[model samples]
Target: MSEVLGHHANEILIVSIVAVVAVGLIGLPGLFALTVPIALFGVVLLSWVAMRQHDRRLCEQCLLSMPLNPSERAVRLKRRFWMAHTGSEPRFLIPYVVVLLASNFATTTTIGRIGWAVMQLSMVYLIMSQSTHRKLQPWCPWCSEGGGGAEVDETDPVLPQDDRQLI
Candidate 1:
């Protein structure tokens, strides 16, 4: 999992640098109209590839468990965003922050601004979706290797032995 995270970190870093450079050289007018679709498609393709590489299966139960109400969904998204930035794997926050700062510094037109906003939202959605997926993977039927259901023991202690005893 760490290896997969590292690979994604490198990919995101490269994309972040290219995005900043491209935005800095906004000499071509109306370029966002042409690039936005391609960029969005690339984001989806890369996300699919990363999921396949990580052997993640979208669990039906997990998908259904997510809140359907817009307000609840927004709250959950906000929570996940905070978790991504503050959790143990906070390294992902670096590229996200870089892109955000670059967008503010370099976006000059309304179209460019909208495109950047969409891209940022999409990236965050994908990242948070994967985080949620991985967190529930231990119980995902399809992600269980060579089994129809999860093989992991649900009663296994997540805390240290001493802490488990205290609990």
Candidate 2:
């Protein structure tokens, strides 16, 4: 439980830091004037990449290094869920970039602010949904090896045959 919570906390911290920095960059005077939407889009992409890398590393470590344990299962399931959700990171960002580009061409204070708010809200919702699902069902064979309380050899051969077949 602690491990799962710790991982969640770390993810939240990273996301929060990235979001703050992105917002700060967007609010800069010269920065915004030069590349308002472009800068914002870049920040989003950079942050997403950073987060994805972090997730991948965590997943690899959990899958390879850790033993089959209850807490480990939770982490694996959470990681799998995140991977599935973020599988199309580039595709997901396209619409936002398009909106940003459109906004840049003809800026409107109301629409721009609302769009930013909507993006933030969506991000928060995604994080919350993942967290909730992790809590509800933390065991998954595809994610964790301890889903059935038995550790199976994931890399073992499916069948054995006589040596003559090889010849």
Candidate 3:
């Protein structure tokens, strides 16, 4: 559980830091406030569209490094991005939405806002990490492979198997 929490914390912290720096550098009038929210919304919409297709192939580094035809490549790339963005499931998005909504009603003061941010971030991280760990971790090449995962396997038998053959 600590491992899961730690990973989410690191991810959120890095993203927060980068966003803060970006906003600082660009300033409010530069459309940082406007474009980021739109982009984020677009990403969520695209992720939902991709998830509707329901492809369950592991999209970790190992699969990505394999050579694919143009059409197959496009599909795999969509699946890969969807998995990374949405944990390959719609249910996983619930906690985040709840957190964002709840945060608004929970805090008004500066200290309250700070405390709420910490509490909510921690809560969401714990929930997401535990709930999605098993499903999402397998799609991570290293975690699924006991930490010695290969980045790519050129000799993998699936490489020579044509997708049309299965169709």
State which candidate has the highest lDDT. 1
- Cα deviation at 81, candidate 3, in Å, is 23
Candidate rank order under TM-score: 2, 3, 1
- lDDT scores for all predictions? 0.51, 0.50, 0.45
Instruction: Tell me the tens digit of each residue's lDDT in model 1 across 1-167.
Output: 64454435434634654464455444334977567646745765664566454434334444555555645444445555344334324476677577766776545787666666665555655565545535544433344543643323355435655766677
Question: Clashes in each model (backbone N, CA, C under 3 Å)?
Answer: 0, 0, 0
Best by TM-score: 2
Ranking by lDDT: 1, 2, 3
Instruction: Tell me each candidate's TM-score.
Output: 0.29, 0.35, 0.33
* Sequence-dependent TM-score of model 2: 0.35
Clashes of 2: 0
Candidate 3 — which residues are off by over 4 angstroms? Answer: 1-31, 44-55, 60-100, 123-132, 135-167
Extract clashing residue pairs from model 1.
Answer: none
Scored against the true structure, residue 42 in model 2 reaches a CA lDDT of 62
lDDT of 2 by residue, 104-139 (tens): 434247666655556554555465544433343335
Better of 1 and 3 by lDDT: 1
lDDT of each residue in 84-141, candidate 3, tens digit only? 4454345866775676567656656666565556644453344344323333333543
